[model samples]
Target: QPQNVIEKIVQRYAVNLPTPSHKVAQGDFVSIQPEHVMTHDNTAAVMSKFQSIGAARFNNPQQAVFTLDHDVQNKSEKNLTKYRSIAAFAQSHGVDFYPAGRGIGHQILIEEGYAFPYVMTVASDSHSNMYGGIGALGTPIVRTDAAAIWATGRTWWQIPPVANVKLLNTLPEGVTGKDIIVALCGLFNNDEVLNTAIEFTGKEGIAALSVDERLTIANMTTEWGALAGVFPVDEVTIKWLRDRAVYLARTQNRKHERINDERIQDLVRNPLLSDSDANYAKHLTLDLATLTPHVSGPNSVKHATPLTTLEQQRIKINKAYLLSCVNSRASDLRAAANVLKGRKVADGVEFYIAAASSEVQKDVEKSGDWDTLLRAGARPLPAGCGPCIGLGVGLLQDGEVGISATNRNSKGRMGAPTAQAYLSSPAVVAASAVSGYICGPQSLHPTNPISKTFAAFHAHPQSPIITYTDNATQTPPAKSAPADVIPGFDGTLRGEILFCDADNLNTDGIYPGKYTYQDDMSPERMAQVAMENYDPGFTKVAKKVRVNDILISGFNFGTGSSREQAATALLYAGFRAVLAGSFSETFKRNAINNGLIVLEAPQLVSDLRKAFKGGEEVLTRRTGWDATVDLVGGSVGVGERRYKVPPVGRAAQELIVEGGLENWVKNRIAA
Candidate 1:
């Protein structure tokens, strides 16, 4: 019974059940109590949900962390009041809290040692995958999932399938980890690793990548459609822990006993690695030496172009950014400074820079990288998620073409939907800013490009091979009270269909970023702006259709951001269910937690598109195509065509039937 790194870490945190075997494998729904649950500005929304669930005190206060970083630059009384309220809540609950400008929550978690090796951490952010860089098993959960953890200290999660990605050779000078991930996303755009966990191997190549580089690569795996991208805990990881411990002790004047060398050595002695015979759904080998500086957007992460091509295209840029949880560490700042050493930004271009955390900012300032960037005419923003989440200053204006070192460039995420954004490494971004267009650092500095080869293969999915123990008599944990009776699900839903044929319908398109931090938004207000970014006529279509009509979309619906409001907005807009070719895992969980029905039927979606004769409009208002979804029967009926769909598990059905996990947890607490 060989287990991969992800499986091994999951088993360590999995709650024991009364079964013949305690071992866990891929696709098994196991209850887990994670070491930490992080929420940033979204903490306010989670707090509301927690209170709604009748939770007076945290089940494990110390395990929770609240950070205010998303909208740190916002000084509006409303925003400040919300921040104050979050601080008050954290203090009252005895939970760790970081105020605005402290740093992005994800980076703060790493800086403070909350996300350690082999630890299971979940955050209310898609970028939580970044923690996997440090050998931790980190994943994203919806706001409801966060609230559930607060109420009960445990929640159910299905172990995703794993993929093995082996890196060979060392990276070229100009090509950073951001380029490596961007190249992967662009080259493997066909849902190759969608919804799968990834394990990076190849000891020599892993050793060559700095911790900052590893963090950047792992952070963008969210954009690459993977659930997690984990690196092995080798000497590189151990050294980082030791260095961090020393830095903490020297700067904060406090000893961090848990992160000392002895503990780190013990961890390395029992390093977590996939067994030799562990099964992987897919395998990819990358030659890092062959990698070139790449840019991945203009709107989509899947549209990757080598920097040479962009330089040839002479794509002019009006704005440039080097900030986000992904890049903006001290190393990234140094790279940017190296490119902008004695140059100035183009006359018409505006370049903005922000560090990942205040601690990182201090480090760069001490190293003179911060001064070099400022002297190069880069505007300094607060050490937070400035302009990355479409907040604060430096948002792209209409018709602006911008390049960024951030992880995502989805439409309307950083600014105007009509504006275009391209993604690149920090060096490339700085170079582009100086050149007044998109270009790599190589354009300014001479370097020879390396040529190399690699191999990859997709293995057939394998069934889990579990070894059972003879301990069937093990008792499960006792329930505090009897569970209240929840209404039964009929397994049938009927609704008219509203079709949106666009693929990659990101969360930003579903719910605009402007309203994301408005914690006091009512359902009516949410419905009014539902899909406004994607299609302005969406509300009109919703009004014309029946109240419980189903919303249908193309592939990868709800693909960007971990904002649960994306699902809730649709729910409040009267969509009884969402039928799509596929869904983002985070969005699926959010929909399920909010009791919104979600079904996947790719062929059926294509057929419906043909039946409606809908064009390429973002949203189509059709007259017919009524659908009846049968979850238990595992089929969907639209007109006379019957389409097969996977059956929903009982646990998920129970959550939907009970009007979400909040009600389920409430009933359990009451019982």
Candidate 2:
């Protein structure tokens, strides 16, 4: 049971445990502790529905949380309606709703006492697994689970077979958490072990990373089809948490009550580690000493290759972006800024910087390091799911190229369908910003980099003024921006109903099985499930393969799960776009990231009831736009229209072609 011994033991006993099944029901199942179960503004829409259906309090409010980090600055009545209502819901139901400006969800969760070691958690959002930094299990759940959890605090889940990641030594210079994960994406991408648990241990783990760095690797577990990620939270973790508490007490709300210390004294004051005898489904040690700057993605996150493996001379980066819950830590920002401190961004490349937490942003701004980045030609943007999501900066245009600090670089994820994205660390993003192509962190950032935390992010570029919506009334979908129009194609339209319609949909609804073990992203298999999962009739209605389909909705559509696979499933189903009454922030961004159009169609539900006559051709405002239908009765739309519905920039369009960052890197290497 010693740390080194666990690896060999797990390897020998792997076959005895559940040998990587996508789905399993445990009769003698141990109650795997919930790592996390979260909801944010996005999932609040579904909660509204749950309430309407006569659902009252959640079974266990302590297990639930709500964060208003998004759209919080707007004092508008509509925004306030949604934000305030969710807050009220949390207050009424005894759930936690972190105040706006508290920073992103996962960051706050760790700072405010939620995530810890040896626990399993699922969220309505994808990145919830970030808690793995503290050795917790984190997973993204679909809308089906969302509803069930909304009514009842618990939902069913099969304990994922574990994947042991053995770390043998310290990380190499300029190599980091980002490289480790991207490398794994390439190394363990086969279907044999998808949707597994990844546990890291060894002297290598002890030496290489800080708790924050571990979170970076943990955040992207979803891309690996992981149920959650875990690392032993040691003294280092406990210290960071306590220091953070002090940091927050002084810098944030001075009056804010510290986490109830008495109740969590052991966790905050002295956290424990996983026993050497701990069980694992699988174990694979990584030689962190050998790791180097690597990049991933021209298509799936699985498309990973070493920096040396890539044909760097042929690659051109149109954009260099730094953002994400993972790498946006202050250490990363300073590393990136230091690299670009005196250098200008490449001539043709657009540069962007995004921080994950407002505190981190404040730290950077207070130090004025942010000014160094801006002076270096990188446009400083507020922290949110930036280029990582389609809504913010670094949007890849069709055939455009980009380098980013995000966790996943899945195809079209930056924006443009043909665009390509490369995933790397902050130092790598900085290096790429200077060189105008994918480059290693060492090329720009040096060893023992200097970092500046505790600056004023809000006062500088001014991160988005988070506006809270006090009410969760369905925001009727409407074209929030003008879209681009393309000439109609000569191909036959797939089905009479270009899309389908429904109310209160989530990404999980669009793609039911993303978290399943197979981790299948195949076009045929995914399209097969698109509408079928919701309404069996969707399979046939979506069958007309030649034409684009559209799906319309009534209200609060696409409410749960940040899985881009949701949009991918719809795209593969021959749907061009999603025309909905409203979309959850994450799902809406996922639509744009995958190159599918998601436009506001408040009027579609009314006019389309009769207009959806089976014989009618459902062409929309955007030609490439596609959608699908739920036979039980619903419609969907995808693709661009006259309105620029939360779009990615020209640079981002270039990254989408490879389907994501890993594939982009692979393609870059091949070329």
Candidate 3:
């Protein structure tokens, strides 16, 4: 069937994009100056690098922004210090700062009127991709890259490889993009397609999702290894962008063209279908009818079978949660409520709901959606990111397991380092809330599918908080007397390794401080928070180990949020090396980009765990620790065929000795 509705979406970008091919493909770098650039408090790391590189003044400070959306109202002075540091620097840099009143970076950006259709954008946060809804290419950059652009308004991207996610059949009325993504995750087992650009199309997509719903799905595409997931520009998208004052102001430039209109027309006239002969390392198809509502966990997301198969697993869950960008919309909230309306939650089951925006919360409350949730014993927390960030409400207890709509559930990410949280969609979360165990939407019927939303929560074209600023103090990059700092990490000489053989430990488990960290923190202030996952802080134990002291783990290590703080925690904690049987594709790149040595050996993972004697000598040569890991076999290899663990990319290797992105910039500037 022709995706008549989708043709409209496809036509928009395909036409507006004069050089779509430039934006497509790997190794071929693409360069396009952004209409706007945005950053967060954590982005301070990059700002420092920009300064080191002799960066001063933005092309237009009014267009660039900084905010303290994370770790606001620091609980401890240490955390408070982090915010103060960033705040001080932003003020001096003349970068706009959105006060605490604004929410996350993307939210505040739209609310403040920064995102506009047919424009280009880059952010320090991965979820920046959410901007694609308004018809802009909002993607993340490494701190160093952001700094370079911050100083020069010039940065480069390897034109990304493109994949067409063709949606075939009509979606069931109750279904959503959240459900589709969860199902898609089950199709791709590993991150073999990381850093590629994904474009969704096909007959079933038209009218199947609102632009906001599409934004919610695209927001999480980072987890899928996409550089950006885009849709063609359309009248609906242009309307959304036109609503913003900042957008209107930006377009006031005489040079600005109504590119959106022609692009929309172009897309309709000559669609950019996936090349008939375009080679794809992966091509997958799904039957919307055959997809059952599901939650992934107790194993790989690819292991997500069906809700019916859940009871067979009998994995009892302590809580069921739905919210986050994954499934936080009126439709999602309505779907969950539809299941629990007159029913009482099961014994031993705790249910919680979080709204992505207060706008969604208001809609839910106005319609008495809150009543349904409250009656069903589901707690509705503040609109700010909750367990989706692992900082506050809805965290899992140690040894406890819960089902959630958020992406990536690594060890202790939600709460207790020992606790396991499962990832699924709103329908699955809602159903499991009643069942109090791992199960699917079919287990409850009528509510077997989930609905997703994001951009729509704010129906109005304007948001009150428009910049990433508060008071005018410019915070500097954290600096303490080199001696004043306690040596959380002192490189050891083949020191004894402190090994835990758990596989797939998500970054959430390593840092588990997204909310806390974002609440207004300086890296130093938030430094101790990294160890909060373990009693008395894991750093204490980590510090006892020597340089080259290996921290060995099971398969798929570092599987959660893309925050560099996770690696920061491990690096500061005195460990010098990461030896895992297999690495999550993102974490592997992240570690190398940050200068951490990460080696893989899958079979040896179990043996290494058993071989660990606290402070046990871990010789690089003795353990066969030198190489790439065969993720499946636990074997290590080297050179071009190093399947077990390939050599780090050249650009990544350059980053290693330079300390981090900023330090690297400092050297580049000094030189």
Q: What lDDT would each prediction earn against the true structure?
A: 0.82, 0.59, 0.57
Q: Number of the top candidate by lDDT?
A: 1
**Model 2 clash tally, residue pairs:** 136
Candidate 1 lDDT tens digits, 1-671: 67888988988887743343555666555568899999999999999989988989898998899999999999999999999999999999999999998999999998888889999999988899999999988999878889989988977676776778888878755467887899888877778778888898888888999899899999999998998999988888888898888888887788875566677777967878778877676777777766766789889999988776677789999999999999999999998998788789989999999999988998999999999999999999998997998998999999999999999999988999999999998888998999898987656543313111101101121111111111112422111111122258666778887788888999999999999999999999999999999999888878776766788899889987778899999888888789898888978888878888777777888786776674644465664777887766567887788886655545556677778788878987887
555-615 in candidate 3: lDDT tens per residue?
A: 7678767776677666766555677765664565466556676765444565555556457
Q: Candidate 3: misplaced stretches above 4 Å?
A: 1-25, 47-56, 72-74, 84-96, 108-118, 132-135, 234-282, 311-314, 344-347, 439-671
Q: lDDT for model 3, on a 0 to 1 scale?
A: 0.57
Measured against the true structure, the TM-scores of the candidates, in listed sequence, are 0.78, 0.61, 0.61
Once fitted onto the true fold, the runs of candidate 2 whose alpha carbons sit more than 4 angstroms away are 1-36, 60-62, 69-81, 91-94, 99-101, 144-147, 249-279, 309-311, 441-671
Which pairs of residues have clashing backbones in candidate 1? 481-671
**lDDT ranking from best to worst?**
1, 2, 3
Model 1 misplaced regions, further than 4 Å: 16-20, 445-581, 594-659
| Minimal lDDT window, size 10, model 2 | 463-472
